[model samples]
Target: MGGGIQWQQNPALCNIMQEPWEEPDIPDVEAPTPRRALTCLSDEDSQKIYDSVPRTEDVFNLHRGDLELHEKLGAGNFGSVMKGVFRRGGQLIPVAVKTLKQDELPNAESELMKEARLMANLQHRNIVRMIGVCRSDMIMLVLELAPLGPLNKYLKRACGRELTMNKVIEIMFQVAEGMAYLESKNFVHRDLAARNVLLVNEQFAKISDFGMSKALGLGNEYYKAESAGKWPLKWYAPECIYYFKFDSKSDVWSYGVTLWEATSYGAKPYRGLKGCQILELIENNRRLERPDQCPPGVFDIMLRCWRHDKNDRPSFRDIVELLRKFRSKS
Candidate 1:
């Protein structure tokens, strides 16, 4: 078991400013117009979001000159991630550098800043560690490299050939532990799926992709989205889909889907269903069927997470304890 390794928490890394930040003037960058209509932020709005985050301390402020870009790791709608080497204090450290595409700069800058601010204060072994931030030609976030990549892809590639049943359970347990920490901090990871979970190794999984996360206001049990954007409907709780309300319960629902993905060796949820069809199924009280390899006890936990009432669902902490007991038995 990997339980012998103690959870590492870095208090020094928590340094985010709570004061209001003023917007800054940004020069226009010439780029090709997007083929599709994209909702982008104005200079004022983007600057306001960026300025809200205080500059990283010198220790966390990386020099762009010392960073060497390498192979392309992955690419998404807003930006692409590259595997890079950052020379810090005369040491060559491997890192993953995230950069926005020139065409997406106007729209994604604020989101990138938001991700940096959130990751700066989050210090846990199971969460992707923020190495530093670089602002040169474009904003770049330096993060700890997870060589194995996303958990979903990793699971699909291995196809359970090298993974034991206990190993899968341990992976799920680690993700729950990470989510439990996020819940304790009152931060809602709007996106929580195997695709967002990164594998550091066969046994170590870290939650990544915080661009969709939101920090709940003090005393607020849930955060309501003013606008409905793209969301993972298959992983969402009923409240999230219907009311645009999100909390730990919604995340627990996503965790259950993630667990299903792991047990089924990375099968896509609702493989042939459309968003409207999924809604209809949920309306009729239908839920995902158990994966072929899923144990009775594990599937029972999934059903608990899929409860029609959010309040009736188990919390991440509760899920952690349950998984621990199950792990002990396995």
Candidate 2:
């Protein structure tokens, strides 16, 4: 009454003369739907997994004196690996025993099973063999013992300050030869880091650990993406980083990195750089160079492996031929 009779109401200000206005309404918007949840493993699935593993009821129980544990050879995510002694011809024969941790992923168990299967089938002078495996509630692998352990580790302690040219050349040449044979069998070592290559004796370089291995086949494309991503950053190739596609060419890149590590006398490769920084360097045309002991010819091979394009890298066969030639000339 006061506004209408005595005062003028300003539109910019609150209009006292007007009745209280109802709030303007808005239509409700719903939140987005979330992705479907992953399916849990059923009892049947677990049973099937249990049934698929390798069992060794024929062998004596680990508690018995049939085989005695000697020393821990290595340790990994699953369990501690130890050297064992089994009596044969009144002498103790050495073997490697890898015990599995129950906490590991289902796929890790599957990978171990695959490794056992592959080792059972392969009988090569340069490849490590499976003596036996147990599939009880706890899993274990009895393998042909590598008394010398990883070559790089052995080389590090032996060649404390530096590496001789002959040693580097000899190791690389043997690696190339083993790789060539594996390639011929249509097998690609998905993980070929220095650790995977073991020494039977101080002189024998045997390719061990087939968990990350690929058998030649074409119908398995659906699983390739899931299967291939697990890689050691220090040894991965540009192709593996860029596109997740690793073939024999990817192995070549690892070989080059291995050579770098060997030539360095166990110095780490690209220690200062993070994974992203490493990718940046590679994209910008940078690669890890050979260590001081690397011969000029081996250095050339390292450079060749650093090619940005995967197809441009040399094959294992080519590596063997080149190494042979280099050895002959030297």
TM-score of each: 0.81, 0.74
lDDT of 1 at 111: 79
| TM-score leader | 1
Backbone atom clashes (below 3 Å) for every candidate:
0, 0
Off by over 4 Å in 1: 1-56, 328-330
Most lDDT-accurate candidate: 1
Worst 10 residues of 1 by lDDT: 12-21
- For candidate 2, the C-alpha RMSD (Å) to the true structure equals 21.7
How many angstroms is residue 36 displaced in model 1 relative to the true structure, after the best TM-score fit?
42
